[model samples]
Target: MVEEKEKREDLPPVNFSMFILSLNTSALVHLGELPDPHSQQKKKDLALARQTIDILDMLKEKTRGNLTREEEKLLDTILYELRMIYLRVSGGK
Candidate 1:
């Protein structure tokens, strides 16, 4: 029991970017079939999506015109999806 508890404690704390990356990875692995919309996991997904949008906004400001065409496209897609998720969570105005 002590060893199991220690192992659990040794795991890293999930952060915004890490959580987003995890969601992305899991979504890809599962072909985008995520948890129930009202589940706690969904809440984490929403939070991660918001954080991803904030990070991308900062990156856009910091690297404007410095990214390759493909990079720009990818960032645009990510930002758009994040915005959609944000609006859904915020009760679409």
Candidate 2:
């Protein structure tokens, strides 16, 4: 039983939003280029942007006054841009 408990603890946490946030943060850090850059870098940025939207979808359920006003607004802007990027990537009308 003790071994089982330890194993469970080693598993990823149940907070999907937090997981997504972590992924987004990592992607953003590695996403070199913005506002104008090489094609390859732009591709990376687009991928990160889509990932960020997915993160926002998860965050929508988790954020509830846990963030400051500025933080929330920042998240909102990220979500908006991500959605736009995702739409474009998906070939939106």
Best by TM-score: 1
Worst 10 residues of 2 by lDDT: 32-41
Tens-place lDDT per residue, model 2, 3-93, is 9999999987765345545655544543432422233343345565556566676676588578767666666766676566456555762
The CA lDDT at 12 in model 1 is 79
Q: Alpha-carbon error at 84 in model 1, in Å?
A: 1.0
TM-scores, one per candidate: 0.49, 0.46
How does each model score on lDDT? 0.58, 0.58
Q: Give the count of colliding residue pairs in each prediction.
A: 0, 0
Which parts of model 1 have CA positions greater than 4 angstroms off? 1-40, 45-48
Work out candidate 1's RMSD over C-alphas: 7.6
Error of 1 at 70 (Å): 0.3
Question: Residue 83 in candidate 2 has what lDDT?
Answer: 61
Error of 2 at 37 (Å): 12
